[model samples]
Target: DQQVKQNSPSLSVQEGRISILNCDYTNSMFDYFLWYKKYPAEGPTFLISISSIKDKNEDGRFTVFLNKSAKHLSLHIVPSQPGDSAVYFCAARTFSGGGADGLTFGKGTHLIIQP
Candidate 1:
């Protein structure tokens, strides 16, 4: 089974603090990992990603780390802001799958940036 799991359903943090979200996977074939941020009534926007070959990646205030040996990954948001208060979804995918390949998303973690 190709299952991506986000253990925490939500996380709360003070503004300007670091917010860390964790995710795990059961399938080793997943090559592409992505994180999406969503606001109310709007579609999720791609925040960052890392290929399976890489161990760590970062973008400005966002960072993603992948550990293939453990089948675990995490997203870190530094100096969390009020605008960053939204749901975050972690996803993984592969192109070589038998069917039309697409993203597999976790339920999402509701990040609360306390202002």
Candidate 2:
């Protein structure tokens, strides 16, 4: 069974607007989560992240929020720009090992920013 899921296959937002992406996980073992943004023919790059202990984390225009009790997390981008149009993947992992083997990623959600 897929432990992490992004229910929405795609999301469209107007430029200069706010974009919100949602993710859900069923595994309680997951203690840390990350959001990765990927462009066409390019590898995913780390965008924002939030730990289970914190409810929110922000980095400039990108912000991530976690609700441990609900096993849910969201990424918000304010003033969405044309360059922000890409596929966003939600990944989760336990704080066990330092390797990437423990990471679980959701089927990315494509965000389309229209100008």
Candidate 3:
């Protein structure tokens, strides 16, 4: 079973608009949440992350929000641009889960920016 889930397979938005991507998780033991953006044939690149203790985190045009009680998380991108089009994956892990290779990942959402 997938602990992390991204229900929406894709989203499209106009340039300079905001893009929102959502994710859900089933594991309460997951204490860390992360979002990664990937281009075709390239590795997923770290985007933003939020800890269980924090409700939200932001960096430049990207932000991540976490609702522990609902077991939900979301990623928001402001001023969406054509270059921002990519596949975004939501991931989660426990601090003590052991090893650096352990992360439960969602299938990913493809974001398309229209000019």
Model 1 lDDT tens row, 1-115: 5399998999999999999999999988899999999999999999999999999999999999999999999999998999999999999998784773799999899999998
Model 3 residue 99 lDDT?
60
Error of 1 at 82 (Å): 0.8
Show pairs that collide, candidate 3: none
Assess candidate 1 and give its TM-score to the true structure: 0.94
TM-score, each model? Answer: 0.94, 0.95, 0.95
Per-candidate clashes, comma-separated: 0, 0, 0
Candidate 3 per-residue lDDT, tens place, 15-102, comes to 9999999999999999899999999999999999899999999999999999999999999999898999999999998866356548
Clashing pairs in 2: none
Deviation from native of the Cα of residue 96 in model 3, angstroms:
1.6
* Alpha-carbon runs more than 4 Å astray in model 3: 97-101
Residue-level lDDT for 63 in candidate 1: 98
Please say which candidate is ahead in TM-score: 1 or 2. 2
- How well is each residue in 1-115 modelled by candidate 2, as lDDT tens digits? 9999999999999999999999999999898999999998989999988888999999999999999999999999998999999999999988766654568999999999999
